[model samples]
Target: MRILILGTGGMANQHAKHFAAIEGVTLAGGVDVDPARVEAFNQTHGIERGFGSLDAALAWGEFDAIANVTPDSIHHPTTMAALNAGKHVFCEKPLATDYAKAMEMTETAERLGLINMVNLTYRNVAQLQKAREIVQSGQVGTVKHFEASYLQSWLVSKAWGDWRTESQWLWRLSKKHGSNGVLGDIGVHILDFAAYGAGSDFSKVFCRLETFSKAENNKIGEYDLDANDSFAMTAQLENGALGVIHATRWATGHFNELRLRIYGEKGSVEIQHRHDWSKLLTCLGDDIETGTWTEVAVDPVPTNYMRFVEAVRSGQNLEPSFRHATNIQKVLDLATVTDRDRSEHKV
Candidate 1:
């Protein structure tokens, strides 16, 4: 299978690396806005073809699929182009910054009968899969309240960028370059995870976004820095479960932490993914003090990339499909609206 990757920044290389590991996949080439990045990415990944634009790549590079690793703002366009070109697309989430555009992309893919998958990475995690199964099996009873968080300390100080060749911190802060800051970047992952584990959709959201250090730390001409650095929201899942979502790039001393807990009438489940994959935890009975949260073992499944490839090969519908992602995007769009209304009332 031939696959062309779009965007040379962020996790593009990681996507390339994983695609190369697939049994029958080839990394045809990639396109980037930066010529230097295009050259560097090609050299580092050992891909032979590189293009300056998506049109060039699509025209000249023959491929069966596109792994779009572009920034959030361009996700809709890139995926649409790939789908229109008759290539399957594996896009990173939240599908698009614009909710209407996201819906259009989803509809286009469906209308074309193309295999479209969203890179909601956590859905591919083994422990989380186990958690989902346990909850869906009625082992946990009906979910009541849940909390999930994705946290990182990169934006706590500018030093994170000094070490990496490319850091998304500044671009993420620019409304022109990126999508919703902390919420879109990390919070979406939490929402996907919670929704996947709880076996329900989000019915409503009440959100609060923060950009705490940007005003004080940013130099006058440095950056507009309008994107959020942190966010917290409460949501009601379709199962009547009350859930809380929190994400931030300003947490000190933590590199990357994603943790979730789902409580139910009979028991609760907790899962965490950080430096290493943690075990799935489950507790039965109603006794809080005396109950024990034991670890539940889970067998590994194929990576998200592998699943996408398999779906493409077999003509099967992909999980976390474009439609699934659009629902998540709707929650995010509504969250922003809810936040705006609440903030305006406070004024």
Candidate 2:
């Protein structure tokens, strides 16, 4: 499949490498507003063409699929344009900044009969998938509680008074941009894990959100401060299971640690991806009478982009349909809107 990537961001770089590694999928090329990024991407990946605008690339190098890697603000337009162009699409996670636009894209893809894949990359992680399998195999019995958290220190300590904190990267931290904050970013991951593993959707949410520090990005003249730096939520799932999902970027020592533990009547399983380590640990309950805690080896995960490629060509269902990701988005939405106090706004 010929693919065109549509952004100059870091995530755009990741998708570039991911697809370049695949054999059957052809990297048709890319388009980005930033000249340096566009040039660098084409050079690094040996892409055939690089356009300065989405329009030129969409017109010049007709693509079979598009990787929408731009910021949260443009997901809707970028995706809609590509779908209108009759191209399959792969958008970075959180789908859109919010559910409405995300759903629009989903429905547009569905109406146009296109294959749309969202990059909730963890769903493709072997350890996470292995944990899900362990739970579903009935070895875990009835799932009762779940603990999932994603942590990082990038935002808090990265020269706090920057445009990112100020309104410079305002679109990201803004509630309009689907609350592109940690909830939209990492919360989506755990929500996906919960729904995908337990086969349940979120019912209601109550949240405690805070922005600990905000230094003015003197140069950007934007209100640079904390916005949902920390989010804690208690949720009810469709299956009557209770869940807690916490996401924060203010942790002092941790850097990109994703930990998930699912408890059940018969057993429990864990997926721990901390730094360079990726592990899946299981503890069996009394049902077996001789159950014991054991660590299971998770298989290596293939890039879901490759699978989406196969699905487009063969008319097979993508391992994760957009519908699945939307369910995850509902949880994200719940966290953002549930405890809304009109006067209380973070950042």
Candidate 3:
């Protein structure tokens, strides 16, 4: 399968690395707004068809699919164009900056009978797969409550760049480049993973967003800092389970910590991404309090590269597909409105 990748940013580079290692897949080349980066990326990867424009590449580049690794704001346009041009798309998360656009993109792909998958990377984690199995097997015994938090200290005021204009964080802080701030950036993963583990969609939500650090160019009071830096929300599942999801870039001393705990009548399970070993732990039965939580083995899940290639070859849809992602998007949309409207929002 021939594939063209959009964006030469970090995620694009990561996708390229995976594509290189997968058999039966060819990296057709990549496209980026920066011509130099595109040229350098092609040369570094030994690819021959890099282009600076998506339109130019879609017109002349012969490829079966596209890896939409661009920013959140561009996902809708890029995926729609690729699907319209008869190319399957593997897009980054929060499918689109807005839920309406996400619906349109997914509908278009469905109408075309094309495969559309979102890179909710946590789905491919071994621990999460086990968590899903545990929950579905009744091991958790009807989850009653759950809490998930994804924290990073990189966005703290003390860590801010010397100047906003020279700061690489400007785009994220500005609505012109991205949306939903931390909520869309890393919060979507938490929502997707929680839903994946619970095997149910969120039915209601109440959210609060915070922006502790303001962004500025070289001069103060030049640009408005509108994006959120932290968010906390309480959500209820269709199964009537209640949970809270909190995400922040201001957690000091935490580099990248994503922790989730699900409690049920029979037992409970915890998934920790920061821990190097014993990432999945569970305790159950009457002796739950006295008994120790045993480690669940981490059996690696299939890589997205493998899944995408096989799905393309077999003409089969893959899990974490756009349809599944739309459910998560509904949760996010509700959370946004709940924060804005300050009322219990139904999904």
Candidate 4:
């Protein structure tokens, strides 16, 4: 499988490294608006070709797939172009800025019979995978409730870097810069995490979003830091489970953490993914009598990157497909509406 990385940003570096390491995959090239950045990325990854724009790359038409590491807003257009060009796509999360665009991309990919998947990232978490397996296997019986939170202290700490001065971080905080804020940013991941772990899909959502002032007047140079910093949502699962899903960058003390607890009539599952490590704990059978939670040993799972390559080669679509991501985006789009009207929305 030959792949073209659609952006030269920070995430693109990871994509390049992983694809380069895949035995049967070729890096093909990278695309970026900045020629220098694309050139440097090509050199860093030992790639042979680089294109300054998607149009130029499509004209050249050497790669079989695209790893769309572009910004949130750029996903729909670039992905559509790739699919139209008969190239498979592995896109970053949220699929698109809104549900309409996401659904279009999903429909296009399916109609073309092309491989399409989103990098939900947390799907690689062994604990999350294990929790889903447990829930689906009836060990958890009928899920009744779940609570999921994705926490990050990037705004409160320099662990990732200074967001005040960095374009990468600042772009995420500005709506004009094609950012959907915290809810648009990591909200998709947590929503996917909770829903997938619980083995259910969101059927309804009531969301409240908050954009805290990070600067004087909340303006940083050409960027408007108006994107949401935090969000809390009450949601119902298709399986009749009630869940609280939330995410925030203002969560102090935690660098990056995604925690989920799923409760059912017969048993319960808990998953914690902090940084890159994950742990799973379960309460089942006799252990539930004493409120005892025992750690469950979980095996590793293939990452979205690996699965994308395999899907491309095998001509099979995988989970976290574009359609599934579109469903998640529907919930996210409804979230903004719920926040605006201060009311719940049926998904």
Per-model TM-score versus the true fold: 0.93, 0.89, 0.93, 0.99
lDDT of the structure predicted as candidate 1: 0.83
Q: Count the backbone clashes (under 3 Å) in each candidate.
A: 0, 7, 1, 0
Query: Which tens-of-lDDT digit does each residue in 1-347 have in candidate 2?
Result: 78898886767778888887778777887888888878988888888788898888878756788888887677888889888988888888778766677788889889989998888888777888888787778888888888888888766555334435444355455554445577776788877776677656776667777765454442223333434667888776776778788888777677678888888888888788876788888888663466566788766877788788787888765857676676666666666666574222211
In model 4, the runs with Cα more than 4 Å from the true position are none
List the lowest-lDDT window of 10 residues for candidate 4.
Answer: 270-279
For lDDT, the strongest prediction is 4
- Candidate 4 lDDT over residue span 1-347, tens digit each: 78999999999998988888989899999899999999999999999998999999999998899999999999999999999999999999879999889989999999999999999988989899988999999998999999999999999999999999999999999999999999989999999999999988989999999999899999999999999999999999999999899999999999999999999999999999998578899999998899999998987889899999999889999988999999998999999999999999999
For candidate 1, write residues 43-128 as lDDT tens digits. Answer: 99899998999999878848999999998988877888888999999998888986799899999999998899998988777889
RMSD, each candidate, Å?
A: 2.9, 4.0, 2.4, 0.8
Off by over 4 Å in 3: 157-168, 215-223, 275-278, 289-291
Candidate 1 similarity to native, TM-score: 0.93
Estimate candidate 4's RMSD in Å. Answer: 0.8
For candidate 3, the TM-score is: 0.93
Stronger candidate by TM-score (2 vs 4): 4
